[model samples]
Target: MERARKPTALATTPGLPPQPQVTLTDSNARLTATLPTGESIDILLHGATILSWKDAAGRENFWLSDAAKLDGSGAARGGIPIVFPVFGTSDGHGAEKLPQHGFARNSRWEFLGKSTSEAAKEGVKLDFGLSSQNLSDDVRAQWPYTFGLLYSVTLDRGSLNTTLVVTNDGDVPFEFQTLLHNYFRVDDIEKVTVKGFEDAPYVDKADQFKTKTQAGAVTFAGETDSVYTPAQGPGHPLVIEEDGKPRFRIVRDNLEDAVVFNPWVDKARSMGDFEPKDGWKKMLCVEPGSVSKWQTLEKGDAFEAAQTIYLV
Candidate 1:
């Protein structure tokens, strides 16, 4: 995979804080980042999944299910899971009929090391690599496309940044989907209001693939699953408002679609992996993705998608 610049010196970031120290520990199974402030981020190498991200005040911006399995058997039930090559079960669109959300989140990834950027000095970055060359025979046979993935997780002053860089190393072009299945923290599913998607067109996955236009800000009252497009508001972040105040702000770049979902009651109870029947009340998935359009990459071509999150 194409490598980023070597870790650079901390550049002057007027609004950002001091740079953090990044380390790989837990027997090379996890990477922990400690910022100058009291905040920290933990990334598990298993799936290149973010296990935890705490703000300066030690408040968590992510929600990991209480019943989540952390034994490295598969992807954890929470935090932010990267869905690539495909977002979900095939409903058409030539998506690889592989596992739900694909193997990126289920298979282990190589720790490709970390780097720093002069543009963002207060931030510390960790990188993980995955490729068809490292996949199990079963997975390779299912979707025989040679690809390289470089996933980066960063924590700076007061923001969390996750970036995915995909490279097509195969001879023929391949079609795929990519997304950040972000499970954000919430006090009440009923009181939390989401913005940036108003007036956007979406595919109501909960309603038989029905296409509809968003009438207003989104709220969770029942089962909610919709794929929104052009989610980039004119100049605004996707804000999560609670008790009439903003709490989480998310921004995505190089990604066209955004999916917001909450299984609510019945659906939440149906998944064995998700513990606590009422866990739906504590989390909301506002996924930034390239789902509405199938991204086709030719030989040696690459694509990158990134999301930055701030706790307000």
Candidate 2:
């Protein structure tokens, strides 16, 4: 009797539409979403941190430090790092034991799944999840609280949107802060100017966190670290311009504060992970989040915020 022939695999079966171009690479540590127009984004599971975002012209939109550690040893120095639980150092409330910026930026998150939308604009959304049960022993012991985080990253034709939902799964209330630390790539720092915080009061972190009102559009002349809050009113969309040309437009929802930071010369060199020594001159950070004050989440409650960056 003749043996049965083996089946052959075809690249495209019949006449069905081709599947979306999304993949998980780098040993499943990274997820990439690509559009038909050649725009794409790369997200690392280490922090759900967006490592790269390229436009149709293959130009990078975010700056990743040359010396950034990609081995999951520590937080990456660049890209969009998610800050949660606490921002910078723990202020108080039995959270002094927690590490600066909490564990969100260093913890490994679960790749929840992916979805697609074709409403007003075609887009792909990748979801990541992290919870109390997934934390390391050390992180759990620091500020014990049952919480769950669902982070969604959406990429469209000319924009990227990131939304974070924090849920309290414990019986008691907990206080926390969250921010999307964005390191925007620029041709030169001297030509970059941030618009929208003209009259908003900001706390200058470089000068002992003293409160000061912005005189006009923010410009970097030296080391700058300021947290602009909604003192006057809720924030509007902010535009990042280079030599009077808009580069990126940032729109925030439910995120009440914005942070502008540049380590400059001494601080840049002081950071062991910031490579090239002068990388500061090529990058500017205009971050949006709910960080000026802590948000209280009661048991079974949830809070959500989002930020969208449009390429101009």
Candidate 3:
């Protein structure tokens, strides 16, 4: 009998740069993207939450609480949590019965896989999907509308882009609100200032939801929960500066409202999942969304919005 032929190993082509990679870990519950330049991102299937984002130098760009639950027990306390359907508690408009921030942050999403594009600086984009059929009976009974959500997370050289597409799969129209609750890590919350909201009108949620206009760039003092509608319009870039130097710049597409929040001392200590009691001193939330009013989505129609955060 002739001897079996030996198998040969495949080799990578020379002179080409290393490609970006996407890895699934923790029994496929988490997806991580590593770029050729050493930048990386981690996302969980639960709520499709982005848990961590690191630069090429291995410095973390987002904050994740030490006490955050990663076992899918509850919404992670930090990082970027996606808010959909109803923002916070509903105020009538057909979503009053829905839970706070709706079900997107609490529901498990399906990983739709990843794709690469040279147009995005050879970056990799991961897609996630959540639909009405995937919802629990309790959640479905509360809203009773068939909808689909397509979330894309792209990791580029010096930026991260997140886009959401909401499709009305049912026969009736539905009103909803959406936002990206980004918990950004900072060296010192007191030294951080958020620009691009100057002269904008905002609602001070910490003060009985009073409406006020922002006089200057936002700074931290105590408990802060203000939602601003920028006069500069939807595509303007919001800059986060620390110690008079730019740290991160956020640009939103089709997302008009911005929310700045920090639980501060008292509220931070009250939250069971927020660690170290003083952990609030190291994080700030500069969220972009469409929360000033409910977005009405007609049947068979879709609405899309995106935000890109760049390191500075």
Give per-model TM-scores: 0.89, 0.93, 0.94
In model 3, where is the ten-residue run with the lowest total lDDT? 113-122
Candidate 1 per-residue C-alpha lDDT over 98-164 given as tens digits, one digit per residue, 9 for 90 to 100: 8899888888899877666434676678788999998999988878889999998877777888889
Instruction: By lDDT, rank the candidates, best first.
Output: 3, 2, 1
Give the RMSD in angstroms, all C-alphas superposed, for model 2.
Answer: 5.4
lDDT of each: 0.84, 0.89, 0.93
Q: Per-residue lDDT tens digits of candidate 3, residues 171-259?
A: 99999999999999999999999999989999999999999999889999899999999999878899999999999999999999999
Could you give me the TM-score of model 3 versus the true structure? Answer: 0.94
TM-score-sorted candidate list, best first: 3, 2, 1
Q: Which wins on lDDT, candidate 1 or candidate 2?
A: 2
The segments of candidate 1 whose C-alpha lies over 4 angstroms from its true place after superposition are 1-19, 91-96, 117-120, 231-236
